[model samples]
Target: MTKNHNSQHKDLMLQNSQKLDRLLTRLCKRSGCDEEEEHEGGNESVLFIAAKNGVLEILEKILKDKPGAIHETNSLDQNVLHVTVENRQPRVFEHLEKYLKEKELWESHVARADKDDNTILHLAAKLSRYKPRHIAGSALQMQWEVKWFLFMKKKMPHMQFLQNKSRKTPQDIFVRDHEDLLEQGIGWLKSTSESCSVVAALIAGVAFATATTFPGGTQEETGKPYLERHPAFNLFAFTPLWALFCSITSLITFLSILTSRQQPQDFRKDLPSKLLVGLSYLFMSIASVLASFSSAFFFLLRDHLQQVVFSLYAVAILPIAYFGVAQSPLYMDLMRATFRNIPQSSNRESEKLIL
Candidate 1:
């Protein structure tokens, strides 16, 4: 039933896409102008709308039908690249970039400035009006913004230092525009660090106590643990020390985050990397501490109450499972945002647009 429903949905979308294609073709023919040509008044064209909304299929179709439309600019002198970057449409931008580079028009198109003398780099530096649905937190969002600016900077090296009409360079615009976001990111990082650091500290303290006091009392003569010969002894022996080390490492990492200068550049990699490391160590510590407790419980109850040992193991797993499920999304997001590669235009020829 689920597969059938999904199939039906996909078919519907395909049908809708076909109808849209036909409508666009007819409109282009009737108007006797390309997709980017203005409508009756000064309203934006269909091509501009598609680029802004990241409707890659529509944009691709239009570009294929009328290649010259790629050069047309709106009243504000903003081209397809400007629209895509301002609206945070990475896919569309990538497609257009590849198309332009293939045509050997990359330098000319990328160097175009709008009415305000704001280059594509300047537009990239400005924050988009829409919030990114994929990135969760404000801090991660800031990280993406910085990453995008840097990506555009690399694409147009000469334009990076060029000032706009307001006499502000792209970097200057970025700093001025993202000041509030930077502050919010700092606050978010500090709060997250503070909360996680407390947990790490508590785990460290517990692990230290457990490591000092072995599961079984020591023999008076040899001063060796009575349970040293037992099978679970190795687990009980190793896990607490591992837990202590991991928790201490987690604590230090979080402390670094809390104490970070948190410049805008830090959001690009440094801060997120630290947060990822801290969270990773914290998770390892939790698992290790739970394993130590479970092993100790299993050893104590193995001979007397074997059934209780299984129950103890199950009980020990519950918290770790809960923690994993609860924090998995955040951890995954951080990992992706911290280490994700910037989208690059591919060398392959652009995919043919099906009309």
Candidate 2:
């Protein structure tokens, strides 16, 4: 009896496989299925053919029978959805969305990118030639991703940032194409983009310099440099100290601003102002680091090795600054994501109509 049961199970599995294949074949041959063969000259494939005919009903049946069929890659190693997008057929999305919605494919496939490092969202955005349909469709797809992300966030509150193979967060890529949407929906919620106005380090320096005095040329018992009580210390002591403090404080704050995410409101209002803000901070940081080193060299350089060390360190400053400048564009995009809004489907549709 056990042997009979095992044989029956095997036979049933084989039957199911055959049934699935036949369903796929029938779906492929439906009306409006002029899609090219698997290795044919045109862009369409069998999976695309099934999708293009508005035969989503049959496609759904096949998918239900053989769930893994969607994972099959073509000669280009692209998943079915990727092929669907490449074909630029709106009807393909109709069937694909149905399959995805029924299967809850959003969370499962959210991070998947095709051969060209393009995610489904990326493909949708690239379907620009299809205009209003593609724009509206892509927005829906993005909304699905955002919903899935929010669901995951609720379930896993500790999830700080989601990273992909490209070392980018979903927000990173999303903001690149939909900056305003991100800012409106999510960017304002984070505090990393707020501006800092106080020059903190400079204030501290001024206070320190005001407290010291060289009095009466009397060397202390410790044989160290002593202050001979002088009125000059009382009057000008606070001035040098304050200047030094302000310089240092300004420098640190400037560096912080440069490295911080650029605010979208600022960038959108005036590109030059945003740029000047960055340049001002970068310049201040460099000058502050240099002034600190120079002060240490003149007043605190205790040994010959210190001079050599400062010189060697100075050599690295420009190269480091250059690399930081090179990465400015990427960080600018990230900052914009925090404050910018993505255009809505209706607006994009209207724009397409205008075009």
Candidate 3:
């Protein structure tokens, strides 16, 4: 059986090599033509052939001979690597590994999508027969995952399980036969607890401070009050002191969260990024809450246009806030759970995205 498998692989390799050589000759012949020189189509044909054949040796030589060829994109606005993954050609991935190793391509190799905006992994996960050529085992899989994840994590981490053009996720395609793996992923996310205590505390502080508010010459104004009066969005009513209290509370919560994560030996390393991310989220959330509250108040006061605008703005803020808070795995899990219930919408979005 081993001999037969080896012999088959050898035959396939020879056939592929012969096909690639013929393709190279044809492309070389066309490279000098006026029609080929007129557009990117011919250049793409050459790259597609090289990438599809996993002909890294020839590709490297071409790159060395004409570095400008590396910058070309195909008809669908994809690089050679993108075409390789799109075709589910493992040889292309093998060639890519060698190319990246020699040239540190990650710095220069920007991911371009097809008409559907699908990333390489997005294409791979959808391809049932796709298996990385040179790379093998969990090591290569994990490496690719990390690289792919890092590339798209910020924009759409939840997109892993989300369906794409082919109505599948990389997770779905990769783990189609493994129910346990799917369950494990969902279970891990669901287990992470959501953090709302700080937010609740901040809101409570706002309410308390609002209750303590008094205008000038009032009884509380004579005492040392928590906050002073500021011009409200509505000049008709006295401005609440809640914003000051909420801001202070949120700032304290942010600091506390930062402090808890700090290590004595490596305090500088961890604390700054956490502080920045946390504070940015807190400020944005507080501002949004204030905007929504003001909008609601104005709506009650019959300011229809302002109310509509503010309400729309508030609604738009939810996804952004979700992203800001998604550093908390629990919030992300909640989003996942919520999204799971609306699979039809998710699939629709995926289809639209693929389109």
Candidate 4:
């Protein structure tokens, strides 16, 4: 049912896009103006608005009908590339790249600056007014911002050192524009680390206590666990040990994130990777702890209350399953932010946009 609804929604969007394209085409013809020409009231041109909002279909249709529209600029003297970069429209920028490459106008088009002498790189350095809906936290957002800046820097290395009217280079502009985001990212990382570290410490302590205290006590003569010969004994013996190791590792990983330098560059990979590791190990420790408890319960009830063991297992699994389900989105986002390739031409063939 959901799939059908989504398909219907997509079809509606497509139909609307086609209607918009026709309306724009007719409006251009009637006004005897190019698609790049601004309205009488200084409103943005259809092409620039499409690029800014990431309306790829509309932008493509206009560009296809009027190939020269790609060169048109807004009132600020910012071209399509500048507008796309400033608004963080990767798909539009990628489509424009294809057009530029086909026309053999890469150098001439990409090097153009706006009225403020801000190149595409400079615009990319500036943070967009709105955060992307798909990205979650400030730290991941900063990572994406860094990735975009680096991607553009790779595309036009010669322009990296170019200064705007304010005599600030792209790197300088990035630093100046992103100071608040950087601080937010640091606070986010530290807060997350502190919270997770406390949980990890608690899990480590529980696992340690469980491991030290044998189930059913020790036999008087041999000093061995009374339940050592039971099938469930192995689970009770090993799971707490595993849980202990995993919790300790998780705690250390979170501690590392807390003590990190928290630089802008660190958010690109280091901090996120550490957080991912810490999270994964913490989950493992939780699962192991649950398993150890279940196994110990089973060891005690194996003979007299065998049927009750299944109920106990079910009860033990609910929390772990709930935790996994609840945190899956964050885990997935962290994994993508940590390991996903930064989009650039060098790796363009293999790079898939996470945005």
Candidate 5:
């Protein structure tokens, strides 16, 4: 037997299952060759190897051949599910776990411990010990950790309180391992909240000034604004007042975020909740500020309506439309994602986020 065959077959499974099938056909015809046969030093059976590498099809096929192979262990005595999580193969774990349940071995397979008495839940939380390259941002990294923790809590409620040989529960391990990630998450959340607050403050200042300054100047004796008799001037007065209100609300909302306690748990609902409401108020302020500008400008140029006023209004409303058009999709996504009630049992991937 060429030593290259097992290594070659493993590589084949990773790249193309079709090519692996062709290679398996030839390998199976030869004498004394088998997928389940272990290599030297009790290295790894094909089943454990596939799970570690996330070759789901090969893992499934090997299990089909020997139903009891679900209980097979590696040199470290870690079963396939443990190996899958240890190697950071979450997708593999999902598929493999479901398969074990289908085969009526969920209890036996998931409960098995490794040499150190660390079960699959331990391996899942163990992921926080190292930062993976694919999870790019700190906030998202914290979210991923929460997602894993929740999944494990739902799957094995007893596992939360179960301590390993190191005497650390899974939650304890997460808190210990993800200290840096948690700090970064706080920094990112505050930075985002403060930036939005600045925009809200500027809007508040401008709208307040616009509300106090009458467009056509005040009447000489009564001290009431000129053009107050015109119906459009009421709109001119009210829109800026409306804008000022929304801007103040937005400013207050974002300021509260800066003062909030920056906990990892806050990111799940509290932070996103504030962000959604703040953005909504800011968007309202921006639209109303533009409306106020349009109405006031219209009052000044009302005499020129036939010639230049229509063109001027269209030119002025561009910024409001631009702000609306640009931010609507993001606004909609935040509203939907932050408020939706996802079940605890389901493993949900985070949505594509924009900041």
Candidate 6:
């Protein structure tokens, strides 16, 4: 019976998309259960397998077939809710909440404790045993980590003060489990900041030199720029000024990342948020430098450089695009998830979105 159940679960996970009714019948027959009986046993049940593997379709079908299975526990005595949180399955997490509420099992199962006297909140705190690639990278990975811990904390307020069998609170477990990721995060942030600082310093130097060299030379008498009245010269003057300011701002922010205290809380909102702002400023500075260079180039070569304009613009965009494509996902994810007022759940399903 166990062998048959494992085989069926493996097939379902492999995406053998039979109708729920037909699949249930086959599972019943293969396991030697009569029609209309819920498949039973820990880890062997369809519900537990679906929750553990993040197969939301199979989970929903199992729930509809045997709503009681929503409360089923594995060898560790954790229900589907606990498994979903521990697995960090976003889609299953969202759908399960709705299912639990419709069936009125939120309180019984959500706060339900496992064998170690650890609730779903406790499971959420431990560094995941399974890492999903959908999370992008370590920076965003840590952000989502904090986000889930906070979500679970809010969902179960009493969980904040609750201690498990080991006598450690959820916060303690969270801080401890995340130690390695936090160090990795710090390394990522510092390296990112260091690289940006170099780029910013480079821009500052180029902008300074461009201003001193004065695109079309200076007037012999007044020491004024020669093309002071031309619109392109106005662009040349304004863009470098903007670039210099932005790069300086970026440099300061990245410098702060270098000096920030690498605490667990720092990863939550302090260091990462500042890194996001720094990256934004650096991006703007790079854009400003491109504009300044193009405008100055036009001023210096108006008579000779008309044909090469398009090619030159394309060349300038390559580096800018490279930096953007490489870093935009982390920036977008951090911006969207951090610094927001997350709504708390009280026996109600909160609509969860992927970061």
The lDDT of each candidate is 0.83, 0.45, 0.47, 0.82, 0.71, 0.74
lDDT of 2 at 3: 100
Candidates sorted by lDDT, best first: 1, 4, 6, 5, 3, 2
lDDT of 3 by residue, 220-243 (tens): 555743223434433313223434
The 10 consecutive residues of candidate 1 with the worst lDDT sum are 345-354
**Candidate 3 stretches greater than 4 Å from native:** 1-43, 89-95, 98-110, 128-169, 172-355
Candidate 5: list runs displaced more than 4 Å.
1-69, 72-77, 83-98, 128-136, 218-234, 305-337, 340-355
How far is each candidate from the true structure, as Cα RMSD in Å?
7.3, 19.8, 20.2, 7.7, 9.3, 8.8
Across 1-355, the per-residue lDDT of candidate 1 in tens digits comes to 9999999999999998887876555544533344334443365777876676566878888889999989888888888889888767778888898999999988887888999999999999998774423677889889989888988888789888888889999999999999999999999999999999999999999999999887769999999999899888899899999999999999999999988788999999999999999999999999999998888877667788776778768878999899999999999888878777573222121222223
Error of 2 at 312 (Å): 4.1
Candidate with top TM-score is: 1
TM-scores of all models?
A: 0.85, 0.26, 0.29, 0.85, 0.68, 0.79
Deviation from native of the Cα of residue 192 in model 6, angstroms: 1.3
Question: Worst ten-residue run, lDDT, model 4?
Answer: 346-355
TM-score rank order: 1, 4, 6, 5, 3, 2
- What clash pairs does model 1 have? none
After superposition, the stretches of candidate 6 with alpha carbons farther than 4 Å from their true spots are: 1-42, 336-355
Tens digits of per-residue lDDT, candidate 5, 259-354, equal 988676676667767878888899889888888888887766767665977887788778878977887765655565456432122212111100
Model 6, 1-355: lDDT tens per residue? 9999999998987664445545554444443343214333322566654555565666777778776777677766777788788877667888888877887877778768888999788898999865543555576577778877887787788878788899988898998999888888777888888998999899888877776667778888999987899988888888888888888999999999898787765666777788888888889888888888888788656787689887988998898899899888777777765674341122111112100
Worst 10 residues of 5 by lDDT: 346-355
Against the true structure, whose lDDT is highest?
1
What would the per-residue lDDT of candidate 4 be over residues 30-49, giving only the tens digit for each residue?
33354334443355778876
Which of candidates 1 and 5 is the stronger one according to TM-score? 1
